[model samples]
Target: MAKKKSPPETLLLLPKWPSSAPIVDTHTHLASTFEAYRTRYKDHATVFDMVRAFYHNTTVEALVDVWCEAPVRTVWREFADSALTPEDRTLKWGGIDYWFVMGVHPHEAQHYTDDIENDIIAAMSHPRCVGWGEMGLDYHYDNSPRDIQRSVFRRQLVHAVKLGKPLTIHTREADDDTELILKDLVPKDHKIHIHCFTDSPEFAQRLLDYFPNLYIGITGVITYATNTDTSTVIKNMIPSSLRILLETDAPFMVPANLYNSIPELKGKRLPISHSAMIPWTADFVAGLTEGKWDAERVMIEARENAKRVYGI
Candidate 1:
């Protein structure tokens, strides 16, 4: 008798989830993840294959793939054709419709120039580009001087406002300045999201009160046992209905619980995260809701919320 074939190695590495739960990953870095996967998987991996593998267990149907530093042209060339187009309209991520956000991150503030601004202006004309960001302050790293970071962020904010597109912000130790600039510049009618929010409840409340269209994006950070603050903010501060959304911020914040489950990645120097693990984060949110909200309800509303804010 012929020997039976073994299952694909990917099966063992992925987390299990209920297929009935549909999720939309509101923010991700698929371009960076694509590069990482290409290097690791070599000739064997395509983005389609990566999506297929990701969809096997989780119910993530759509994702907004964001780029912080790379030019919008590069982002579009990599994902728009294979990933952004929808296989079906109703399903959203059912066939995983993809979208993108473009901006210069604070880290690259030193490089921000007229040429960069022009590139962003030209990119705004693209149909698939729905939002502007992964931009804001990061005083902790201060990778770029504080003055430069503020200037670059304000420049992008001006363009994003002019374009009538939503803004995705990344604020760290520089919350005070972030709030000041945003409050002064971005109109209350325009949408803004604080992506990967790990700030205090006071900060969350301040932003929500200041920006009528502001939304909080929860990532895999809440899944880490050490991240009680994020979970607390989600449970008490953020509105459960439509003002919140889910994201992976992939190739960065993998769900801590799921990360621990994989044996091979336990001691690895660096592990990879992708949009596929959204269900893990969603489940964590459901738990934080404490029977007040279920995973499906949260995911569905978040999907609609993303659609509204991102204009997808």
Candidate 2:
């Protein structure tokens, strides 16, 4: 007779955040995150449904979702519009404050058109559209030609600057060009978000020193063992400076600590990251601070920094 196989351990529910500190995810992709969830579970899940499932017991207060496609996703309007009123926000997003920034990501720089630029400019006037971008150089993939990315980046920077909108920048492995272009084009006092930074500590310090108002958008990537730059940057930052912003950059960079926190997960990975996971990111960040910070303190500081940057 053959021996019977044992069933695998059921995944445990996500641990509840230990503090009342409000979570403000400075950058995320809500629609894409929803798609990831639907694909993973093979279920018909709406964005709000995914939100409820992930954000249930979390202290997620606000999210600055990115809409950076070339043509721009029409679905963005529905989300930005829905959060116009308290009742609608409660009904649609479970009372979580939702805001967005619109622009063409560097990966889509080649496809950028005048019409697309016009569309992004119009969105800047939107009551819920807080800033411009998720835009800049990305040499890691070089999905678009270098020259085209630089040209489109400059054009968008000009527009965002003219409109006096805060900037959300994405730079990967092109630190020199990114630094030069930003320093030449953007004013020192301009509100800039260097989203998902994984570059050298020197590059981070240069940006931080040059642009006092500029913030480093820290994502779950910081918790990964392979990237010490993000951790080092956090450790070196003067705690009183308040230059870090907590974000998940979700549907991506799900914090590795999450797996360790829940033993039943058993080395299995979660298919998606969301705003609710901010605390885990904060917890890891707390660990990096040499007992100077806690998860709640990290959340609170990030929340205040988000307001200063995005004014949401």
Give me the runs in candidate 1 sitting further than 4 Å from their true place.
Answer: 1-16, 56-58, 70-75, 81-94, 238-242, 259-270
For every candidate, C-alpha RMSD to the true structure in Å: 5.4, 3.6
TM-score of 1: 0.86
Top lDDT: which candidate number?
A: 2
lDDT of 1 at 215: 89
Off by over 4 Å in 2: 1-13, 42-44
**Once model 1 is optimally superposed onto the true structure by TM-score, how far is the C-alpha of residue 229 displaced, in angstroms?**
2.1
Writing each residue's lDDT as its tens digit, candidate 2 over 82-152 gives 88999988998888999999999999999999999999999999999989998999999999999999999
Count of clashing residue pairs in every prediction: 5, 0
